[model samples]
Target: MNGSKDIFSTIFSAGTFQMMLRSATPVALAAIGGSMTEHAGIMNIGMEGMILMGAFFGVLGSFLAQSAFAGLALALLVGILAGLFFALLVVRYKSDEFIIGCALNTFAIGLTTYLARNYFPGDASGNPNLPELNLAFLDRIPGLRVINHQSVLVYLTWIIVILAWLFVYKTPYGFWLRASGEKPDTLRTAGISPKKMKWIASVLCGILCALAGAHLSLGQLQGTFTDNMSNSRGFIAFACVIFAAAHPGKAYLAALMFGFFEAIGLRLQGFVSSDLTGMIPYLITIVMMVYVVVRKQRRKMKNE
Candidate 1:
């Protein structure tokens, strides 16, 4: 009984909350971007590729320039180019989004691996770290003090979530974006080009996914870029978009929920097999996806 109590307490500790914040930020950022494209009628499965590209280039830029800001700028530029290229194929040429997405993912993996192996030799341990924010006053607070020290990206993500919610709910462009997915013909009749809206979505998605990747490599991992380091977080962010019904705020919350479970899994490492512990968050994600599918089917049947 004592052991059980201790375990539960440890799982719910302040350290876990910090871990949750760190883990959730990248997914939340990516999911927010994914939600934008989803609302604009684009199924953006290529976020994984965008993220990996950012991870690789972020480190590369930082290594060469010895400046985190330069690294971020390079990552954003790459993201924009990638997004534009993706938009050209999917929106302008009307190619199948799924095939392009798969191609992008494969290409990112191969290209980054090749580049890292050839150009970025040696381990990633010596990379420069992104700066962390320290708010000394938070220590005076009781339970919330854990949030005092975190990556600057964590705070940035919070601002992004608020801005995204406003953008989706309050802006004229947001209305057009949503209408492009649900009623493109109506938008066209109103003199709005749905294709343009899609292009915008793709570009924004790329930039956001790249930012998320930068956060992963630079902020979360402290400036280390490993091949395949993204580790399916892009897919998880896509799932978050679907789970949240493409609402930015809901997507962020869903990401936070996933992050919480992941934090729990990390805490369980000593209590359970390392293999089993690592599976916890992913297993929960699968269960959540299943649940979402079943619920959707049930609603459909009821409506029928």
Candidate 2:
């Protein structure tokens, strides 16, 4: 009993909680990105590629320019170009989104791997790291103070969450975005372009996903670009989107749940094998997917 108690305490300790916040940031941001495209009838499986590229470029820019902001700017530029290219293929050229997304993932891995091997050529590259902001005003707060000294992106993510919620729920563009997915013909009848909405959604998704990558490489990883650093976070974000029914706020909460499990997994590494511990977050996500399916089936029966 005491052993179990200690294990639980170790997993839920303040340090673990702090790691959870950092772990959740990238996933939450990606979930928000995925939600944008999902609501606009675009299943963006390409976020994985975008994130990989963004992390690579983020590190590249910071390493070269010695400024995190420069890295961020470069990443966003890549994101914009990626979004437009994806739109041209999936929207204009009418290619299969799934195929294109898979291609993107493959392309990113190859490209980043080549660049890393030829240029960075190491386990990690530590550039001018992102600034860690101190919440001095919250010093008096007990538990909150512990998390006060996180990266600037952590603070920015909170504001982005609020803005994303407001933008998706309380704005006219939000209605049209949703309408484009559900009722494109109706939206067209109202003199709105469904294609334009989709294009915009793709671009927004790319930007957010790029930001997620920046947070990972610069904010969390501290300007290190590892091979496959994204580690399926994009897919996890996609799961969050479906679990939350494409709602950004709820998706963020779902990401936090996954992040908590990831932190727990990291904490358990000493007690278990690294491989097994690493599976914790993915296992939790799979379990959640099953629960979602069961709940939907029950609801369907009730409605019938």
Positional deviation of residue 273's Cα in model 1 after best superposition, in angstroms = 3.3
Off by over 4 Å in 2: 122-124, 273-304
Model 1 steric clash pairs: none
Supply the global lDDT for candidate 1: 0.87
Give the range where candidate 1 is weakest over 10 consecutive residues by summed lDDT: 272-281
Going through the candidates in the order shown, the clash numbers are 0, 0
- Model 2 lDDT, residue 266, Cα: 81
On TM-score, the candidate that comes out on top is 1
Best model per lDDT = 1
- Per-residue lDDT tens digits of candidate 1, residues 216-282? 8888888888989888888989988988889999999989987887888888777866566656656
Model 2 agreement with the true structure over 69-187: per-residue lDDT tens digits: 99989888888888888889999998999999999988988998888887776655678778998767877788787577788887788888888888888999988999989999999
lDDT of each: 0.87, 0.87
